[model samples]
Target: MKNKNVINYFKQVHADKVEYNKQMARLKELPSDYQVVYKEVQKFLWEFTAGDGMDMLPPMLELLDFFEEGAANNIPVLQLVGEDVGSFAENTLHEMQAKTRINELKRKMNERIAKKISKE
Candidate 1:
């Protein structure tokens, strides 16, 4: 996440604090692998967040719920993300990135660069 957005996010937490706390408690109850993947993915994805990452919240919460469901069902964590687990997180970030304003800007930037390079 952008540093400015991260700071803004923390500042806005008073409203979401209860829900966030509940998620954290659910996190604590997760299996170790789920916990590890969740933290790593969160850090990776945070770097891609735009506008306080408000748009990213729903999917992040859904991820925690997915992990919790898997754990409750006795499903192996790797089964959820697959082998080469880090890639799972990376792929997840890429998916989430698609919905952010930054990604749209990035698309436009690449298009501009391509056009300029092509002398069109």
Candidate 2:
């Protein structure tokens, strides 16, 4: 069952990747300024993936949160692309928040388990 859940998670991640690419293409159809920002974001993501240094998850989440807030508030560039882009940002933010919460929960659980083992 645990293995099945892992498999399903990977399958969902694959599907999300396909949709993410399509959305990125749509974003590229926006004005030049928006395209530039998108390209920078892509570069940041690539570097985050390729780098072999300390984890940058917190900063990456902060960046996403900034964009999400901008889109939700209808900031100029985000508004130019209309509601679809805003919605995408909102969804991404929610997903990231959920993942963060899950990670926190996992960390706590591991700590508790370790303490229990130490006491045994």
Candidate 3:
């Protein structure tokens, strides 16, 4: 059973890697403005990434898809994401329900504060 689990893990990893490569290739085909904005937004998202960072992959992929669509529709990247890019990035994180380092810190801080108060 353990051996089967190991094989499945490797297989899933391989599939994910392949999909990521295809996404990257599609990203490259987008307009220059879209490419730049997408990369910047992606980098911003990773800044708050937690755990092994695998939690970020889905959101990143979704962002890439949006960018690709914007490019296809000839829409300006800035218009799609709005002037406040960081806000857009935060919104994306919320929309995806992805956990980040900030979320972890918030949880820990609240828990510790509650514990301290309860002991009083």
Pick by TM-score: which candidate is best? 3
Residue pair clashes in candidate 3? none
Q: Which ten contiguous residues of candidate 2 have the minimum total lDDT?
A: 47-56
| Number of backbone-clashing residue pairs for each candidate, in the order shown | 2, 0, 0
Q: Model 1 segments beyond 4 Å from truth?
A: 1-13, 97-120
Give the top-scoring candidate (lDDT): 3
Model 2 ranges with Cα > 4 A deviation: 41-120
* Global lDDT of each candidate: 0.79, 0.53, 0.83
Evaluate residue 115 in candidate 1 and report its C-alpha lDDT on the 0 to 100 scale: 95
The TM-score-based order of candidates, best leading, equals 3, 1, 2
Task: lDDT winner between 2 and 3, please give it.
Answer: 3
Off by over 4 Å in 3: 1-15
Models ranked on lDDT: 3, 1, 2
What C-alpha lDDT, on a 0 to 100 scale, does residue 72 get in candidate 3?
Answer: 81
Superposed by TM-score, candidate 3 places the C-alpha of residue 21 at a distance from the truth, in angstroms, of 2.4
